[model samples]
Target chain A: MAEPNRSKDRLALSALGLFAERGFVGTSIRDIAKATGLSISNIYHHFGNKEGLLLAILKTASERLLHELQEASNQPGTPIERFKRLVQTHLQLSRGLRKEAKIFFLDEEHLSPEGYRANLKYQREILDLYREHLLALQEAGEVNFKSPTIAAFNILGVVNWHLRWYRPEGQMSFEETSREVTEFILHGISRVREP
Target chain B: MAEPNRSKDRLALSALGLFAERGFVGTSIRDIAKATGLSISNIYHHFGNKEGLLLAILKTASERLLHELQEASNQPGTPIERFKRLVQTHLQLSRGLRKEAKIFFLDEEHLSPEGYRANLKYQREILDLYREHLLALQEAGEVNFKSPTIAAFNILGVVNWHLRWYRPEGQMSFEETSREVTEFILHGISRVREP
Candidate 1:
């Protein structure tokens, strides 16, 4: 990356780190500067203020997360397969972008009014993607649900909460967690006995 | 209730609201006092400081949630009935004590180290209650799982995240949302024929 790009990346990454550790209101410009090894004034060269840094980080992560989802959905597969792909991609992203993902979940609310609205617009669109896929699966008789909104929330809540307790070196790898959680969310723990 | 009891209830409720909106670091003694129409000195008479107020809320809410769970679990009936009672009671408590619950969920880290550990002790007790119940269901062959944690996560996450989007007056009452979410979680959307 070029000089400005490198600085922005540093700012975004540092912002992510600090924001994740100590929420948005808790993080200071000095803290971000210290994390990035830049002078506070120099930090301003890349992002205007604390809120500016937050907006940049959220915009970058939001776009990246959406891109990952789009790529997964475009792959050839069964509806179930596509759903699995979505869960796997999300789990992988959550691991790779641990700090950024944490900040995204925790601090996006700190954005200025306009930025907050835009960020939520993107968030709702991503949620809508899940809703659409779920509705399709329901109509195909793959699942039983009357409300896509409830379905989407059920799926997202189960998958996204992995950030809180999912450990990379724990007994289960991220992939295993993804597979098991995905199946659990899509299919319950019960099985019918063979006649 | 006596005046003193009502006064304490108002104090705890006000503490929860400030803690939720401003967070632990952002809130001040004066802020809590202002919210409750008392001087900071008067507030101090009840609890030593912000930490005391927070500690009281956490202790009180934890006891409230588990007590409700115990009541539900003891209600007259079978395993399914017991589970439904647990779900309904949990959902009701989650709605009524949302601010305190959110503090437990998102703001526990802000507590003093001792407070944090103490809070965890209570939380672990409640989580164990849910897990042990699930274990009983599984041992009876009522539940089957490749990963028990995932199943538990789905059940709790669906209920926990209810605060995020559940409206006071939607097409579904809190009771209906509770029943609907629990039913979907317990059985999932997958049909037996499809499986």
Candidate 2:
């Protein structure tokens, strides 16, 4: 049981790297098998097909995000504090799961209609978590913004877009970058008295 | 001359739609020609090859963005005003060139090394434009933030990200949505007096 689980992990990790570098259509099952030193049959047995592998990767990443966000939302804090925790947790998870996050954004279109819808559902749930927090902040008179839906998407854009440009070796460490992002977001949405 | 230019525009437009819908590797020269009613050799004649077609599309989009951003930067205003114009221009152009923008983000990895570097330069220029405005704002003590580089990226992320979720028939008109985004960004970066 342990051996099979390890092999499955290896296969998924290798496939994630290839898909990130090449793309869903460009990376074939043979490519995954070659990268992982596993048999094509084994790849099939594990993921069923290329799309299946993509779904598995996306599902794991999405579920992890949803879980973390749920925990963040449940924590006791002011609306501002909870929102800060939510942003920090999101940035940390996104950095930790960088490649998976990239595929979640870029390769999602390749999923079959059913797979696409399922992935989108996860996305919507993740988004709703953000929206819920923003709504709370609005009710608390802590944040000012139009359209919770648009505000939620804007916050996500700021956090998720880092996947394209953030590098660990760059000047700012992950912790520093996370703090900067949180500051920008907090100030961006906080209520301002008329000048 | 006019006939040839029209044909080229058609070819590029057809390829742009196909590339956005299908991954670049998944899209063939034959597919573009079929969609455009042009011969395969004709596509080659106009753009040299598929990579050439991709380069042309990216070049157009990048140049247009650069031109608009430059114009916005040069307009008469404070750093904050210039930044507002810049953001509005970006959202308008992105919404106008939705498919091309999508390809510019997603299919850029497929370019040759030279093409990739060329595209990166344009992107850097765009970033520099954003950075310059933020730096000016920082100098004037109008905005509070760390690392103009990350600030610029966050702004772009917020603006560019509307490509994914914004819909024409949705609740907000393009003008209304643009206003909401610009307002969010303005508040996000503005300096707050300590309580």
Each prediction's whole-model lDDT (CA): 0.73, 0.84
lDDT of 1 by residue, A17-115 (tens): 788888887888888888888788866777777777888777787888889898988698887778778777877777787887676666554567887
lDDT tens per residue, model 2, B118-159: 888988998999898889988988676878988888888899
CA lDDT, candidate 1, residue B152: 65
The interface root mean square deviation of candidate 2 comes to: 1.5
Screening candidate 1 with a backbone cut-off below 3 angstroms (N, C-alpha, C), the clashing residue pairs are none
Error of model 1, residue B45, in angstroms: 4.0
Native interface contact recovery, all models: 0.35, 0.47
Error of 1 at B136 (Å): 0.8
Judge candidate 1 at residue B147 and give its lDDT. 60
Interface RMSD of each: 4.2, 1.5
Backbone Cα, N, C clashes tallied per candidate: 0, 1
